[model samples]
Target chain A: MSDQVTPSPGKRRIGVYVCHCGGNISDYVDVDRVIDAVKDEADVVVARDAMFTCSDVTQEEIAKDIREQGLDGLVVASCSPKLHTTTFRGVARRGGLNPYQYTQANIREQCSWAHTDDREGATGKAISLVRAAVARTRLSEPLEPLVVETTGRAVVVGGGVAGMRAAIGLADMGLGVFLVEREAELGGWVGDLPKMFPNGTDGHELARRLQDEIHRRPAINVFTRAEVVEKTGTYGNYQVTVRAGGEQIRLDVGQVIVATGFASYEPEPGEFGYGAPGVVTLADFTRMLDEAGSPLVYHGRPVKTIAYIYCVGSRNETHPYCSRYCCSAAVHASLLVTAADPGVRQYHLYRDMRTYGRHELEYIESRRRGSVYMKFADDEPPLVTSDDGSLRVTVRDLLTGGDQLAIGPDLVVLVTGMVPRDNAELTTALKLPVGLDGFFNEIHPKLRPVETVVDGVSICGACQGPKTVAESVASGLAAAAQAAAVLKRGVAELDPQVTFVHPEACTGCGQCVGACPYSAISLVERGPAKVASIDAAACKGCGGCVPSCPEDAIDLAGYTDAQIRSMIDSLLVGSET
Target chain B: MTPVPAHAGTGRGPRAPHGGGPRVLVFSTNGISDPGIDLAGSSHMHYPTEVVVISLPCTSGVKPSWILHALERGFDGVFIAADGEECAYLQDCSERSAGIVERAQELMEAHGIDGRRLRMAAICSVCAEPFTRQVRAFAGSLAGLAEVAA
Candidate 1:
């Protein structure tokens, strides 16, 4: 026990603060008992319990104690660090102690909340948790965050509405923007849509206006028919190579925004009489509407009665997620036809009417124009048959309680949902994760919406998920704000909890090179042996390569072997005293 | 100061047998498993407080020696909450962590400890209910083992 209590260089005065959380933790775990249990532990000079430790008054009280007692370290037995780690760290910093010297013991989540019925056990575990924090902080060393300069440039991928908006937003902030589009035209899916909802704005005209604005900006560089060939470097310094017009162009930027738009779902042949004469997809019908005159005509015939099938190639075995735009699109299409020719009959076959938000007005208007809507079940989808040079649709209506409805129309339009673009090549080059539905996954859908797991890159638009045009544009602006915030300060602070290599123990086996997922580790010549060198800017601090080293030569700065061993020992043995 | 225990059947140390009940050490990753555990707590799901959690940067950073050290230090079992596919560290995080657990089990068996004393499970960030159920089941299994030994 004496050997476990290693003497520190300074006066090892420590303070511990436990929060009641207004009986959220107090009712389950005895807070006063915990304070009494750890007050006499090794170097604990001051131990107290608070009603709410995160409150500003309580934080000030903690700061006052730190200054009056001359404390060197602190252990806050409170909620998970995920919520208040930074808040308490700031308390420590204001208390004239290094923020890194503090440790947050998760008593609320792992102890009081997990063991509500066992107060004695929760108190005992809280003591153990605080003891582990004390043990870890006794060996904790003050660390300074790393600061890197920003290049004041950004790379915007996929020049759709989202990408165009992001480029415009970034350029408006006086940052050089490089907008890359894989297609020759910049509008993407929006360029093909005839008009948008709510006010009947032309989609192509909106995209053309954005393109004109982008072309007029001097700081924005537009690259049509271009693709990102390679991306290297870390946050604040990224070298992006783009292949365009049979030439390779390299751009040095600080941040990247991936707004690669979505692809419309294509139905299989004979799935919905798709190969028949007048059967067309919603995209195809919209294109025809854009080209046709007032009276809608298809296949050189005046279209009178039309049948629209919703959720085609979506909400099925192959595609389980709702495309989120199909129901509204179908309703809008029905309204378009009803407005063109009031005498024409329009029938909408859907599993559910999800005409959400203001689009419900269009749904109401479509119904007022004498359009018929029939709901179907998942198991009994609408079946289309082409016989005798005519198309017939059979669907079991769930609304009418298992009644079957039949409709034969001049044209059948399949309301296909949005599918993720084939981002296999881009996903590999960017090293981003794609969800099971094939869309790019964000770190946290609500908290870190546009940000990817990668440090410097972010994702927005339909690439992340099925988004409406307004939602995609909002996501684009949000990503632009995030990027601008990153570069606005002209410097970024990196967490000091990165990997470090000890030259004396390294065998130069080169095993860590393959173990590193971020390719942050490299071998550098040191004396006669080549030791591992980690790029602090590029390292994600995952600590994967730490265990891969056969000689145990590598260790993370904050999570060292000694620190973890001490924590484990403290968890089992309690306090050394 | 007290001498360290030789093995499970050898002798008693400070933590060799305590009235505090069975102690389980949990090694949870900071990214995925730790958050899941927190969610379990935030949801007010109750479990045994005998479990103590230590946050790691990644489960791949766990050393076999550390597992053996916890077992020898008086912990009845060690539960490694791995990150699995959601590991921001590596794509093959589960496979790599399973490799470590395999080696640790071999070391445990060689040292006269039951290989089942150590367990590994993948807990993602949103796996709150699954995590509570897993911990409850694991604790029950350990309790059953203790009864058998008695």
Candidate 2:
């Protein structure tokens, strides 16, 4: 294995340029002092500085140096690589050097910003960062980009609120979409819903309209009772095997979305008599509303008095999170009942009326409408009794000086919360990460709301977390916008900072392939030793495969460890001298 | 009515109000944090004289872009609010938000929009009060600016 692996040798004739950034760095740290310090660094044939290293004029200067001086390697000491690493790399490429030969030093946020009060300390840290980049660049090698042709289509999982909206939005953008729903019908959980609050729009109508629109659009392919069985390939080109209606079908697409909306909360056995006849959940209520048009006329008798129990299988010691949507749902349920039978007395029993957001406004409105709200402490929960023949709920009212109020009515509505699907088979197959609550985790809660850590994959709706119909639709649209934007460009842009595997150095023990969390690296040719090749689009620029390569034949394009560390060394040397 | 605070720097751009009049302050965070406030000129906000522009930063750390946009909207004043500073990496996000609000006020006075109309303030999640107050303040500032123009 050792004999099979050797580092890709670095080429000679290197050029180094330090950017003054128009005194952004020069004013704080002595740019000339740093430049003088690294002028003779090993393998560094020429060194120079400019007022604005990122300017077009400076790029011309670097280009001229590469052509005239025959410089093979390039290093730029300037702002953080995040800002302008691509600019210098482009300059290097324009100057007849492979873009991978260039490296950038981030002396701005990591150093200058931190050490503004202490010039000496800032200079020292800047030098260390630059030297590290220089050391790493010496070990850098040219890497090739793997290009794959896309089928120009996308697969969207789940036919719920999220999936349907994303599908409609994407189809509207002129992209072909295969929207797969796991159930017999589309519209995830929202399909069963009666009415959406605030606007009071019919839920079923929205789903039907969307379904009609999707059906009308030639680009959209809707499949019911479908599931993705196997998935492979990289971003902009994915091979997926889906099982739909007992038929196994394969598809090749450019992108995929998992909008698999969450399942309704199914209380474990004996946890609140969840499955009992009288103990109906929120979803059951939606069904009832759809079927009977009212919770009041249950079994054909007008419900004189009804008690709504909030937070079923939620917010207890077992489940820490307050299923965010329950309060609003409960409030909406109360309004729905009032609309059904105006005379039905609605009593809402709960621990806390956490009617957050616009729901608070609704809560206040509900109160004005004479809906009774009774709060019960967590330890002293309200009691539910169907054993006495009639549905009777007993609760001690905190507002009424400890007096217990017992209401016997025709029915009791249990406002159950949403919970993630229990079976981990599907999530495991995709290698997607789940949150503590088992919902799919987004890349960043704020920054990358619709995007997943895996490129070319986005998630929306309840699959991410509990949200209202409006929120779910908005999220679905956002996800669609992002995915559509990518396809609209007609071509995916590689990071240019990805790693490449040298086949000649192949001791490919398959270690690096396994080390990649993204599953971007794979064994391309399996023989005496498997040949490791990186799918460029799938590789996330995470240097996991670099250190794991036992033979050290693997190297990243832009910011290789050798390149970054050498730059760091150059900065430190400049600091000392 | 008192003017709202300006958060970023003050300025007037090419899109400033025709006849150099006061304009509405439109603060948008690219429909991410403050999706509730529709700058898209939907039926809810059809203020023809009102300017509408989207922003892409946290409701915190609003830049001079807010000030310039408000003046450009051609309303006598401006109002800006959005998501709170929960996960912002920009240090002093609220301060930046406030800085730009102040700068907007300065620009409004210089560009003839009543400075009172250019207001910036913190808006909590799902609460419409801050937004409502800013709208009322913008209207009042527009009235004040109209009186000056008249």
Candidate 3:
């Protein structure tokens, strides 16, 4: 109450205008009926209904009416304020009235649209909504927005293709970007591969292009072997701390993009002979292929037999998922190896030959070559062991219905899988929810893929979960697009669906304040009595404060229990249940 | 015959490399029956991937696995669009399949794969994704995997 923005106390003149929204609401909920019913209300000075109150021409009409009619407060009963609260607020400011003195009533989604056939009930609900707004507007204060400082620069985490893409996108937009990489180099796991799918260009080339572009950009600041240590503040202004090369550096940023990428499972050294001289993971194999520019050779001689074990880190009752790329990578690798040496006996010991797409054609052609395709059931996996000092694998052959066939192979290639990163730390740090698989969760699965439940934060790349390079790049662009939308606004208006404490009725009970999970409420001394005030920017409209209020003083805007009960009563008024 | 886990950490809880799981998930982009039927069967034995059977209509439906995090939290693993190009839903299965595959692999590398437990795949509508078999084999092989030292 030290600097309360209470409105000037006096006889308040209220204006109520209902919009047709070009029949979006008027058709179902009788707009004229709503205006007619509220016209006689004690404090209402003018009540009118318009075909489209949100339209530019109509908004201008509203501003003109306020000036000529000397209106003190305004109420617009139209679509959800989510769509036009700014529109009406802009009009109020232009008309020399404090924009905070306006109230919005949603009669579309909650009433008319919800109760389609019940016209009488719909109209009654509309009246209640209007009445609630009117009541709230009567207690409205002339509030001013708090100006939080902005940090001009931004931090882009994760140095993968998506991180690089976002960093470039942000830098090109004239914003300084700090690109951080967890690994030693800028190119992510993609750099270790042989080539990309479809277009089939060397993965190293794409990595180089991105690395060079980022390096050349003057606005881009690159940091490898770095991790985000701390982040605070709100959207458009954030203070981020990073730990890189054992040095802690703090930076003020306008935004942050979490492109922390994903990690594939690397089996323990002993399991599957992963680290043995003759054994290698698909990633390692790919790296070796890239290094040698050819198939694997043992002791400077062409290898006669090579055994590939599929589902090394994926698909089991325990792990229960397919590392989607392993099969394709194996197929691609097999094709490359076969093309390099036709006489090489390549046995693709798999539960299934998943050479999908053009690889299917390749699998078909490669099988005709010296490459062998075998299937093993989930219950019957291939066993790799040394028989008489010779590396041999025993697998149940699905085609021949046989078991324990030993093949003295020269090399064993294990195809591994992918999973989320150390997401628990990330989830706790950001107060974000993790999926069952322990990945960052998005707000809406389809509509808001990049957006989180928290405003101003977005997730991209494998940090969210499993995905391919192309998909990761696309999601990176999507997250950037979403973050840009919020940044473009420069300042976001706090949503009005928040709770307010009746200062006079409050008894200094800290229950409600403590109950607020969003940390929106606090008590301050107003003369003699301690009053609770809500920090609107931090409120998330969760209504958690209501139950903890012992004085019955806390009331929420847009959805007070009384207002909801009244609306519900009206909806069920003429129904037979 | 012993059940080949769909993912790692099937019988042994923490020993499986990286991935976490008790539930088995099957990542199928198309029908359960496909040209690579054996691969689909193996997919059912892995750790997290063995719990839920996610039949994606197309690779495009994989989204950014972050989108379905709620669903993932409820299960052990999430097996989605697999590797290969037999998708009847999306014509560009090659790119879409590759995208899903890459995403899953990255997750595994990050140690978020349930101790390297979760998985994803790429497959066509007619034949369940081939990555399913690979996932199962990977899980079965995790008996000797080292536990993450506390």
Candidate 4:
């Protein structure tokens, strides 16, 4: 850690650099004019324009100025701070200035690139941006990252295929794992499935293989009929309590992986003739087909013709998203049915065929095997009815110019989609955010897919959203990798930008307590007074508590009220074209 | 107006512009809306050069006075890029921000400032095009208000 020399407010020596970005900024914003305008700003000791501020030569020059001029603060007028904040912060550190005393002016993204038609306007804006940055920097102080020690352990929730795989992965990495399952056994929905797609592997067999691997690892401790009821403490040092059997078991772990999987959407009774004589869910029908002894029978009658209803519980009002696995599941089932009896007629009534990726091949093969697919309009869903001893499905076939057709079939299968498992208790325990779609929300779907807003916690598998077996397992490994990355070093550093409390100013009004989402703030008795205290590790630094304090007791560090007012003054005072 | 006791540091960028059109001061969140607006610039999307932004930790952290202060300090408009449901910290950030906007609007009205000059909307991390579209639309409305007054 670099030593931080506190610079007094009036004596703050700051270096300001305007970057050309090789005309990325200079072409639109006159860099020399920006430097000229901000050269005489308060606390600014050195101001200059650079062809490339991030270049090694310019960096050395800035470092030399920081050392020779004894600069304590820095303002770099360059591209987005997102791109080069760290580079110049390192420059500040090497120059004996605290890194937090540095700030960046996003001239490229906010000014130059945004105003290509007006160079004079861009230059004036760049000048103001630099001055504001200098103003913010004048109040900037050194900040040290909050480092939390880890327990070298992880808790995997769900006990599904994803959870099992994640447990095995964590165990292999030499981390102790607590694999918790709400059920009596390991395998989740996959265990109940007869077969899965692509490899055509028995779903139960895949679950068994993962369970065996987990059992073989002594580091993995399985807790069946157990669930994490509460999670406390900060990242890399979490204390979780699992409700298992008839007792509460507490464990200290570094990370938690939510591979909670998902539940299949069940239709309401009488919807799509769901409770009819011959109608059954696709899950029930598939199991029947697997154990049908070469002849599919429903209600003591051999099934001659079968009609499959796709999207019965999905693509509708209740469930809007398509269950990504059902199309392949149904197609794979049809191939199984064709192998059993080529004489049996199979009809697929549905909307658009979304058997994406390799599953599309399964769709074509199912078609070549004489499985007729009928397109149905979204508004006009197919209807299923039961009579004396028969089942019939009526549908408007859009492919046949929207012709309505009705036929009786021995068996009717309702193709259901995946739904989020009822995890209100666990969701509350972990404080995981469920999306508007009721699925676990991640930070970013593509960039940081597995991690959640809660530090040391990540979501994976169908619980995040519907996914094929392969995709589920892929996300499972990603969550394991995320947990490992944070816990491997046995220490994790949280951003120091998190909230802090001013004890003397705090009236103990408790308004800030409710405003804090992480529950990091609490009112504590200090002598005869109650004051708000902030736990730095738990605070995410969203600043939601700042304005909620009527006493103005709570304020952010770098974005303090004084700095903002100064920046505002710098922008408006005698500032015009 | 006092020293930050021995505690954590807050990180943010404060940006202001000088140009034509209504100078809009947007209080954008660091984690959510700032990146979205940056995406607009990287995509070479153009808006009025006068739309300056002061990045905040969260929109809920913005005091109502900050909004009124920007307008009182010669800014024609004050926009808040709230962290809606995509907020990483609080679940009710948008609601809190809405309350701030309401109070700020009431304050603006008391000061005889046009309430239409202030606005608040959710700006997600990936809402780049939406951010640009919002700035352009807000700038247009502020310009219209100026014309009507003239």
Among the numbered candidates, top DockQ falls to 1
| Model 2: per-residue Cα lDDT over B1-150, one tens digit each | 224334222222222221232334445442233433432111122222222222333443343433444344323445666443431222234554565567556665565454555565555433334454565566556656556544
What is the per-residue lDDT of model 1 for residues A153-227, given as tens digits with 9 covering 90 to 100? 999999999999999999999999999999998998887778778678899899999999999999999999999
Clashing pairs in 1: none
DockQ measured for candidate 3: 0.02
TM-score on alpha carbons, each prediction: 0.90, 0.65, 0.58, 0.90
Interface residue Cα RMSD of candidate 1 after superposition = 2.8
Put down candidate 2 lDDT per residue, A334-450, tens digits, no spaces: 777777777888788888877777778888888887799888877887877666456667898888887898987566778888777653755655556576566786756665787
Candidate 4, residues B16-46, lDDT tens digits: the string is 3455567778889877898888888888888
RMSD of each: 4.0, 19.0, 18.0, 5.4
TM-score of chain B of 4: 0.87
Given candidate 2, what's the lDDT at residue A329? 82
Give the per-residue lDDT of model 4 (tens digit) for A131-232: 789889988888888888898999999899889989999988888999999999999988877767876899889888888899899999999999889999
Candidate 4 chain A, poorest ten consecutive residues by summed lDDT: A1-10
Residue A389, candidate 4: Cα error in Å is: 4.6
